[model samples]
Target: MNLIGKKIKIRNFDENDLGQFLELVQDKNNHKLAGLEYTNDIEFGRDLLDMYRRRDGSYTVALQDNNKMIGIIELNKRGESTELLLTREIGFVIDKKFRNQGYAKEAVQLMLEYGFNDLQLTEVWASTEKDNLAPQKLLERLEFKYIYEADQTLPYTGQHNLVKYYLLKK
Candidate 1:
């Protein structure tokens, strides 16, 4: 099933989306924004798709009228090693050509609804590099409160860096 939006829908990814997915993964800026190591291999794309599928929530944001994949969004469970106090962290990356458009905002709104209401979550979290202000502003627009800045290995990316955190409570 697809989460409907005015001009987009969020749905599970399929093999046919590989081309557009590759395009996104190949774009230097987008790839970096997603905190991924640069790579052009199809195998890495396959691995990424598998990883996305295994997350708590993962969906492709596509055009409602044409089903063209425009971006990807996910909510993955994060917590301490004790298996308690698990939290859900949101992440997204838009196709380079689609940046600055409203698609990412709409898609994130859809995902937040799912995370908060459907998933019965109390809060959703997000983080980005200190230099990534676009995402910071986007989160602020969505009413996410700025948390604190910290230096740590971005869990998903395995990279150590300064990062800013944000949180929104339902």
Candidate 2:
């Protein structure tokens, strides 16, 4: 499925997206900010393909004109708790080259529409590093209320980082 925005398109990952996916992850800044470890292995790409094939609710944000994937955005369940199903955490990563463009905002707005209108979700949340002003600004521009400040575990780095949480109610 595809979610169309003004200048970007959000769609599911497939084999054809492997190269772009690798490029997205290989960027050092992305790894640092997102706290994700990337490997230059075909198995990793296969794993991502399998993930998309599982029909999980995630999408790759791409440019409309060239169909070049520039980022990723998704609303993911917080945990295994059934009560948390109505509340999903929103996450996104834009390529360095695409930063400062409005694509992230547009893609996120599309996901918000999908979550609230189509999924019937009640709330969406996001957390970002305190130093990451871009995402903080984007979330604020979308009117996500500041929820709290806390130490968040970095997935790849295995360290605690200062993070601020934001929430938007549907």
Candidate 3:
């Protein structure tokens, strides 16, 4: 799926995108915040390709006018069920150079539409660290309700404590 925005476009992740995707995932700051690191680009690329092959989730690339991969957005169902009550979670990561350009918000908005419309999800959820106020505020700007907080130990760093947010389709 391709979603066009005013300044960027969100589309399905392609095999050719592996290079940029690997670079983005390897960034220290991005990996620190996201709690995952890719030590082997080829292995990670294979896993991503497998996700695409299964059609179980969506991986979208945010592109600029010249078609640079500045960010990525993803939506995954909680389980195999198609029930409306089953939640879908959304996530995004923007290139450090492209920060504060509203690309994350724009890509997230388009993903939300796809999640609610095409995926038929009744609710969508997202989470961020307590210190990551940017995403929390963005979720609010998107009208996601402040659900609650939880203790989530980072899988990579073993850090605990995280705040989760949720939004229900009206």
Clashes (backbone N, CA, C under 3 Å), per candidate, total: 0, 0, 0
Candidate 2 lDDT score at position 104? 93
Q: How well does candidate 3 score on lDDT at residue 165? A: 59
What digit string (tens of lDDT, one per residue) describes model 2 on residues 1-170? 68887799998876677777777767777766764446667687567656754657678899998888888887888877888879899989988889898999999999999999998998999988788889999999999999999987768998878888999997
Better of 2 and 3 by TM-score: 2
Please rank every candidate by TM-score, starting with the best: 2, 1, 3
| Candidate 2, lDDT over the whole model | 0.83
- Return the TM-score for candidate 1, rounded to 2 decimals: 0.87
For model 3, how does the per-residue alpha-carbon lDDT over 1-170 read when each residue is reduced to its tens digit? 67888878887677677667667767877765754354456787668555654564555556657667777777866666557345788877888788898888888888888777776677888877677878888989999988888887768998776657566554
Local error of candidate 1 at 52, Å? Answer: 2.5
Residue 64 miss distance in model 2 (angstroms): 1.3
Ranking by lDDT: 1, 2, 3
Per-model TM values vs. the true structure:
0.87, 0.88, 0.80
Better of 2 and 3 by lDDT: 2
In order, what is each prediction's RMSD in angstroms? 3.1, 2.4, 3.0
- Model 2 clashing residue pairs (backbone): none
